[model samples]
Target: MFPDTPVTSAALSVATRFCSPALLNHCVRSYLWGVMYGGAHGIAFDDELFCVAALLHDIGLTDAFDSHRLPFEDAGGRLAWVFAVAAGWPQERAARAHEIIVLHMRDDVPAADDPEAHLLQVATSWEVVGRHAEEFPARARADVLTRYPRLGFGAEFLGCFEDQARRKPDSAAAASVRRNVAGKIAANPLETHQG
Candidate 1:
């Protein structure tokens, strides 16, 4: 039940242009998981905003924006801000979208105050780290993975993170890379699936 608004379509198109198929699928799955998670938890959120945030959350990992000194999350949030403004979204909504992108990486996101941001954080974590699997329904998880196959996402995404760490040594990516690159790579949720 992803939003199909023009802005959502444009966001997806932009993401598809920049991201690999695996990353693109991850983005879509993040949105799906966010929506499902929110609905299951009775959290009211703006679906379009969540969709845009999810789709563009990893944009900085792409080649075009990867060169920036900012952490991938900040770079992606900036890019999302610009995209939202250009798409005629009001300043407040644009900022909210930006916040959602930027804060998705934090471990302690305040979900009660901003459900969209919370959902994005949880969804991204779930997609990347396989956390919170028990919170969501099994059927929804299967449906999402079926719709958006991992396609070796673990290797591809870890490679991207490693490259980011190499290029932006002072960034959060580098810190994460240094902390436990092998463990994180091995722990990727997509690595378990052969299909």
Candidate 2:
């Protein structure tokens, strides 16, 4: 496992124990975007905790997704809650995190007061859109722009991906994701959501 560096070492270790490099890279990319959002917006947040939470937010998916469990569903939430509590996360945060992860697929869920939830949404959106862009065509790009407008971090997150794509065009994964992201940017140049 990577060094703790102000975050929970044990959590990081457990969260990443079975993930693939592509998944890990996806997590890093999302976390970096969260860091960028924090830096530019000057939000008062726990950087270390946010970073760790953003990185591990999907860790429970190893079991949850595999078992076809829906975290948003009652049974899924209970299963996820139990797993998170057993995994050593504080009860309060675990309950909240379980809800967010379970309902992450629901676009209508209201944003949580917890800043970590916002950061997690920003990070997860970028990771998913970026990772899947290669398989999707330009027509699908509009969905990302439309779906994440309320996220308030979409444009900045896209800019970051754009910069990375421009700097490293040879990156198969980055290039694939950036293709659609670039289209999203071109389609909506004036869009910048508020955090």
TM-score of each: 0.91, 0.50
Best candidate per lDDT, number? 1
The residue-by-residue lDDT of candidate 2 on 1-195, one tens digit each, is: 223563355445654674444444445545655565555556566555565555555453343233222221233345445655776768876676556554443443323465655665655654444422333234433443443333433444455444444545543324545458556543432233211
What is the TM-score (0 to 1) of candidate 2? 0.50
lDDT of 2 at 167: 47
Off by over 4 Å in 1: 188-190
Residues 46-95, model 1: lDDT tens digits: 88999999999999888887645688989899899999999999988999
Q: Which ten residues in a row have the lowest lDDT in candidate 2?
A: 64-73
The 0-to-1 C-alpha lDDT of every candidate, in the order given, reads 0.83, 0.48
Clashing residue pairs found in predicted model 2: none
Which candidate has the highest TM-score of all? 1
